[model samples]
Target: MSEGKTGAPHEGPFLLSQLVEWIDREHRNEPGRIIGNLLDALRRSPYYGPLVAAAEKTHRSPTERLRALPLLDRDTFYRHSPPLSNDILTGPMADAYVYASGGTTGQPKFALYSNEEYKIATDVLGFIYSTAGLEAEDVVGNIFLAGNLWTSFNVAGRALENIGCLNMPIGGATSYDMMIKFLQAFNANALVGLPSVIIKLAEEVERSGSNVRIRKILYGGEHLRAPTVEFLRRTLGCELVRSAGYACVDTGPIGYQCTHLGGSLHHVLEGYQFVEIVNPETGAVRNDGEPGEIVSTNLTRLLMPVVRYKTGDLGRWVEMDECACGFSGKTFELLGRCDDLLVIGGINLLPSDVASGLALLPVSQNFQVVARTKNSRDLLVLRLEASRPLSDAQVLEGLEHGSYKLAKAIKDGWLNVEIEWLAPGGLPRSVRTGKIKTVLDERHG
Candidate 1:
């Protein structure tokens, strides 16, 4: 089925949409039935008993009644919930596979997936790759970190295998030299990994003056910025750089990019999950295209079903006409995470936005944003790691009139940006993730 020319949801020929419909057909539009079932299931679990009882107090139909249920944050669901076991599972949990989320620190919470959930996850990835221009004979490199409870590499590898592509499971931790050797030796044509990791690898390729055979790349695990996109295009000689999809260990298969605009938008998995954008301050639902916090409810994940779970990411619903690439579902544009947002002089700033603004100027690939409180006032430090220091005249000239325009122009004078020039290796890397800490918030200390 094809989507309508209007913004209404339409049937599509993609396997992922079909699988979603097959798994939970009724829950796609009329989520009340699933909400009722979820309530009934939650009543049987000690951890969710209070939540269910609270919902039961409302003397309304389960569908209409559940809408008033209080939102559940990570602290309530993972930290404060009563001891949980198989009681949360809608079905038997004997065959379920457990995976933990890659939280920055502290105790990691576990998410359970049944046999069918696993299959659906990989199937979604396969559909995403096929949609993002993956060919059958493509040699794919799975550079996402694996082991230590990480799921991206294994999940991506299975997807590549499912689509009958030649894939090498070279985890993200692999050294630059070894990764390059593997890519060259195996003739990798496509790569999938975190954007930061991919950029580091590309930097190595450029430094070594080697011509790698890779052309296509798909980035996930974090926000993909325009500057990074330009860097990849220049260093890796990539033409097709798209988002692998929007997903996490907590919520599987959020959405994927269609071929229409590449990574500008993502086709929300309408049949599989309910996505909502709510005002961060007031908690009111925002209209289509209004920026707000992204809240997701998983329709297919029966085991440990997440209802109105706060994803902590910022994004908004968008209505599009029939996509030229063929998928007929509504789409969402992902803004950066809520926690990563910086408030400078009453203005909200995203690291990705800063990077994109800098992409307009003549800057290097290496840059970082440091937020600090000076004299009880918020200050933003923009660190640019140029090969050599630029003269005051050059910096002033670029800031005034550049291709993308300067950061101050983009900020509209709500905030002032202080530029700091750094040599290579000037910025520090995160000890845990081995990636650059692009946004450093020092005001919280």
Candidate 2:
């Protein structure tokens, strides 16, 4: 457990005074031994004391220090040739888990992280549990995917157990019927699963007759559509805590979610590290609301110091607004990977933005923005998931309506691509991994 006691940042930009108050209150009850250990770690980190102390020397608040930090992209991490300056991780090179995100590679890339880095990331995940109202007495029903050596299921399950909470790891791999039986038989109260999968479960319960009494649901690896939250709340009788968890074999788990207007994921644990969001080209910090690449400096890493390490993710800071969750931090949403972009009529587009818009429509369950090239021209295609199939005329009319709105929003005629709506479970699903790749670019041009 971290010696420092802290809680979630309230939604939106944090005032300096508010940040200080939260900082003081959070650490008030913490044991001195924990603080000493953390301080010792910081002291050992050549970069940590200097960076944070400089901010303090300038009389800057935590937020101000964060603002001074820069963002990074996938290219930068590779160019830097190292994630961190300090060797925070330990293990033979062949033993670490390498997870990649993006780079010169045309696909979502991956890299490896030392085993110790994975442990540290998992250690901090308990903070997410506390935010979601997980108690020691609550037996958590984990529905996150399993099968691959991927870390979500194992890391999360271990974290919950580390906190001394009993966990029921029955989900994702099992069918909906088997999952429900596990949940009911165990009398589980807390639920953690992929956002979309849980919503599908909610729909099954709504259509069929099954009594489920869940108190809280903590999920990630899937974007939480507004309707999914409503469905989970209404059907399962639970408060849905949707979070964007950041963990890579290379970078380790870092960010979590803040249910606020500012953004979806707040890099709250940054006090333990430095977080940045930079323009991919200029390498300069992006202005608030303009998305850019994300980077970080993990403080606990010794064998590997992730200093200015690019995460290949892009997002923007929340402009002047208090979050509904009342956490004060520089929160931002995960826009998508740098490679998850599609070019339409010579314009750059993100699948995440389109998905966010479609999320406003309850029928559009899951979607993929598939782009192909023919005769040196980019063709945009959309594959959407729905509960039922639409007739040709109905599809045409729906496309007309959606295109008009999308064209106006994206300001490009080609932004509204061809829409192919399929019935539920029609879309390709990643059964082993939690994340479903909705945007696919198959253009060799």
Best by lDDT: 1
Per-candidate TM equals: 0.83, 0.69
What range of 10 consecutive residues in model 2 has the weakest lDDT sum?
8-17
- Model 1: per-residue Cα lDDT at residue 223: 76
Model 1, 1-445: lDDT tens per residue?
2221222122223343454445345544666776677667666665566776877786577755555666667776675322344444455556767776635555666777776677667777777777777877899899987776667888898778756778888988899889999999988999999876787788778879887857899888877777778878888888899999888777787888867765557887765666778988888878758888887877667667777778888888788887886656678888877877777656566776566555656556556788887666667777876666776455545544432334454356544457788765566654444456567788788
Candidate number of the best TM-score: 1
Cα TM-score of candidate 1 = 0.83
* Model 2 per-residue lDDT tens digits across residues 355-391: 4455445554566778886566556677777776555
Candidate 2 residue 359 Cα shift, in angstroms, is: 4.9
- Cα-based lDDT for every prediction: 0.71, 0.59
